[model samples]
Target: MENKYEDYKNEIKEGKRTLNQTRKELGLPPINGGNTEFINREIAFCRKIQERR
Candidate 1:
């Protein structure tokens, strides 16, 4: 499937909005992907849970 962000170029240009602002205006999350700390913490937690099984 095509990536959806590619479809936003003209709307973003016409609105004079940054990608982050566009996402916010569309009621999407402020960040597209989780940050490094959240990702690392999730990985560590999953590893700990797996070790108990």
Candidate 2:
């Protein structure tokens, strides 16, 4: 199965726009950072979760 994010780069791009709009609405910090950390952290978290059960 094709990863949606890989197949649909536009979705993430559009989401960035929507997120910015929401951030501005609430005056939150800009979501500008590498997703690598999220990927690594989630992978580790999932491994831990799977190990538990």
lDDT of 2 by residue, 1-53 (tens): 76644544554476754655555555544455665676577689999999999
Residue pairs in steric clash, candidate 2? none
Winning model by lDDT: 1
The total number of steric clashes, by the backbone 3 Å criterion, in model 2 comes to 0
Q: Evaluate model 1: give its lDDT.
A: 0.72
lDDT (Cα, tens digit) per residue for candidate 1, span 2-52: 565665777677776677787776775555465667657768999999999
- Among these predictions, the greatest TM-score belongs to 1
Question: TM-score per candidate, in order?
Answer: 0.37, 0.36
Q: Pairs clashing in candidate 1?
A: none
Candidate 2 has an lDDT of 0.62
RMSD of each: 8.0, 7.4
In model 2, which runs have C-alpha deviations exceeding 4 angstroms? 1-33
